[model samples]
Target: MNLTRTHAHAFDAFDHLATMVAVLRRDGRCVYVNAAFESVLGLPRRALQRGRVFDWFVDPATLKVTFDAVVANEFATARLEALLRRPPGAASTEPLPVHAIVTQIDHGEQVLLELVEIEQQTRQDRETRTLDQARITKELIRNLAHEIKNPLGGIRGAAQLLEMDLESKALREYTQVIIHEADRLQALVDRLLAPHRRPHMVSDVNIHEVLERVRALILAEFPKGLVVQRDYDTSLPEFRGDGEQLIQAVLNIVHNAAQALATRRQDDGDARIVLRTRAARQVTIERQRYRLALELHIEDNGPGVPPEIRDRIFFPLVSGRDGGSGLGLTLAQDFIQQHHGLIECESEPGCTLFKIQIPLP
Candidate 1:
């Protein structure tokens, strides 16, 4: 328990920490940095050790005040917001927004610096908001579907009666149109409420089977230009879930990707969609942590989701492609959520990944 004792194991544990941590001397030189810090900043520990900590901050003026406060013993700890310049070869080139704290770690002789990516926090907030929004959307859709049901039945019946009474074949075409339109609306309404009404039929589900079923369907639809490849962890354990619902949810996502690839590369035969699956340990979905979970990824090599509708794509009736019902993802999200899972999307030109994570029993 002596503070001065050399704890090799404790020091080594810092390298594997999830939080970004750096130890700095009072003169601003970084003495050591954890693996997470290096990974987030894309700067190696040696690189950080060679330079002053302030060199990494985009706004040195603000960081300087906090750095001085902790160094001067005026404050035991100081926190500030700053933009971090992304290192070369990073996924993004833009400066990253982060919450940084400088605190005395060794009686004012050394400072412990912690940097947290704002995006990480923001994403958690968004997930919470998304769950609430999904609940509200389902309620609204159910009410609207019920309201449309009675009138829709009446409209269809009236059209049928009008068609039967008409003598002229050409005039009867108008009544047929009315009936057809009513039927379409009714189908749409049913789709909107389908997830809410369908009972979850839980059973042991082999994820590979579901992926294979969807793959076959995709290949049958776009047999020539597109290829569906499988990347699965065969060791994954079977879990309890609604097999049919899971199939439908995965099918909707893979089908959407196939459709996008086909549309974007009508003449290119190299269009590809990968159905990948893996097991995740200690995963968090919808604010609840699970010891184990199954991760399924639907990735496509096509023009990514349209930027305009990307944020709203999961909302009912919001589609990136023309004539798309946009109910595919909405239903997919709902079905997965029912199983205590989450679906997330990340898209950029030529690469789009839809990740579905569900707890494993």
Candidate 2:
């Protein structure tokens, strides 16, 4: 392919995009491929230029037709879904689904193709909704806790006075139950308000060290059967965060994972949890784009989160297990959000993975 200095300079800008982009003639021969395109296809730019864009898609027939229609002046732009084959042995063997958009470039025969990952769009939408819901939930919880708090103290104090005056043993027993239940509810309310009330202590925090503390705690608690594996990206740079809070946040996730493996533990099966850390580039968090980010995956080889409550897992008082406080994940989410990060969860019958993403400095 040959291009004028002006055309080459203009096309170079596409490399900055996170979306996969390509330029091709009306005949479907590739003229240029952007950096994202090269990365996803796992092919070099020189190699990509050797093949027509039509050949890269699973349904080449549809792409070819779309190309013909746009070039024929039927429409200047078109959007369609197609699957792109990835390199062998990728993490997921399934073909990547993308929303392919094609637009005619001015009056020329060249058409520019931009591919947005379908799954990524869905994830971003979910993240946005989750964050909105969490903000509402945080405010409601804090307000409710305060309302319930004052009455709770009064009730407990009254119960204590009544118990002191009661001569009958039975009456005293009833007062004891009231006092005990009040204390329990008080503890629960305290937990509900903890994240919002606690001051965020900021400093340099190494992600590996945080994971190690959680790992040690999980191992100590479940000393028998569970295996906590570490797969750290040692080169990841430390970021300014509250190390103690991070420790608790990651600990909550690890602890939940360990508890979920109870059946495996009872049977002395191979119960395992993997803590994986990696550096992510060109990432978006809460609508803010960053050049680099840190990604942590807390994966377990246990029965996945129950589908019934999976969507509400981070909401306060939502839990799959009976007698569970259901505040662990809620607190975890709060801590991560303070750092301008997000946590996403995926689960199936035999596997569950929690992915935590925080921007890097």
Best-fitting candidate, scored by lDDT: 2
TM-score of each: 0.74, 0.91
Model 2, which residues run further than 4 Å from truth?
Answer: 1-9, 86-94, 106-109
Can you write out model 1's per-residue Cα lDDT over 16-118, one digit (the tens) per residue?
A: 4555788888888877787777767877667878888888878888898889888998999888888988877889998988889889976788888888789
- Note the Cα lDDT for every prediction shown: 0.85, 0.90
Distance from true position, residue 302, model 1, in Å? 1.2
Candidate 2 residue-wise lDDT, 148-190, digit = tens: 9999999999999999999999999999999999999999999
Steric clash pairs (candidate 2): none
User: Which ranges in model 1 have alpha carbons more than 4 Å from their true place?
Assistant: 1-77, 82-97, 101-115, 263-266
Error of 1 at 335 (Å): 1.2
Q: State the local distance difference test value for candidate 2.
A: 0.90
